[model samples]
Target: MSRVLVVEDESAIAELISINLRHAGYEVTIAATSDQAQFEVDRVLPDLVVLDWMLPGQSGLALAKRWRSTARTRELPVIMLTARAEEADKIAGLDAGADDYLVKPFSTNELLARIRAVLRRKAPEALDALVDVGGLKLDPATRRVTRDDREVRIGPTEFRLLHFFMTHPERVHSRAQLLDRVWGDHVFIEERTVDVHVKRLREALEPVNCARMIETVRGAGYRLTQQVQALSN
Candidate 1:
């Protein structure tokens, strides 16, 4: 069963959501405060988080930002729930890395639907399967990237980005597609951020000389091709 964490200060609403989620075949946990929510996440990372905007202490926006910056929780799928009902608030949540947003007074059916949609979108690339490309091997089981027995020191996000590229190599992926598939479908991060990470990923692969495998398709996006271009000494 998929695990879901619901963070909301309202007891009645929390219970209602938990009941609905449980009935829909989800294992549910509830946190009444931002601190408690963080504690719950630290204890057990859920498959998805349902976060309410108005928390007692830190607030859901802060919590979302914290989660996004943490390597362990960077890719945790989140659907933000809010009473603000403003487009700007929704944008803020997405900018903080929420995978989706729902305004207050939402139907349980809609909530459940959003949860299912986010999970479906994130499931495939979230696997722990190993990926290999262009003589560079990445083992998710070990969380290691190596070539010719030499290890590549990679940050978690870069590792994920590289894994996505390797899994779908030889094809150009537009920045929007990369963000959806690699960074979660609903982030409001700029496309330029993708360029930065791609540059960093190349830098990380430099020692192995595997950097050239990632090609910048001008006016398009990027492609991880099996064909390698010559590298400068």
Candidate 2:
């Protein structure tokens, strides 16, 4: 399920959007202020953000610009939501890096449609395209992984896990996050399952000298990093 962050100060409007989004099978998180929104984003990157123009601390426009300038959130999809209907205001919102803009008193149906469109636009195409990170290569079309002309034999679960990690390289992903993203959320697998698969994935990559690419982030979960070097024992 895609996760969406709704940053709206109005209690009724936020709750209404949250309800509709949840009904549509999206994981929804509510933030009443820009600070809270930033806090949530810092905790875990959401698939998309529904941002309000005006907030108690800082305007959503500023927040959008900040996110756009940041490397981690540069490609984060955002739909600006506000009472402003002026053409200039809309342009400013887009300039601040909003993917789409929605004026208040908006139709919930339209909002949902726009959300779907934006997600479709921003999501990485995993089935057809080939993903390359550092020297590691994953071809979804062939379901193959190779490094330095050597093939890395991995299981189905490990293949999916590596694909996700390669696509979102350098970012920490908790076991729960990995499960939700890699394995379907409908699956009731234990978090320990991730550890087991990760170990197997590393073992498969070991033959290709790529096992060091996957790093455990201490208290965090796992990260696929491009800085692959043999660690000292």
Q: For candidate 2, lDDT tens digit of each residue in 61-161?
A: 99999999986677789999989999999999999999999999999899999999998876656446788877789999899998877888899999999
Using Cα atoms with residue i matched to residue i, what is each candidate's TM-score against the true structure?
A: 0.58, 0.72
Instruction: Write model 1 residue lDDT over 122-192, tens digit each, in one string.
Output: 87774776666656889988999998899999999898899888765565788988888889965778889
- How much does candidate 2 score in TM-score? 0.72
How good is model 1 by TM-score? Answer: 0.58
Candidate 1 lDDT at 71 equals: 57
Error of model 2, residue 130, in angstroms: 6.9
Q: Which ten residues in a row have the lowest lDDT in candidate 2?
A: 224-233
Candidate 1: lDDT of 126? 48
Candidate 2 residue pairs in backbone clash: none
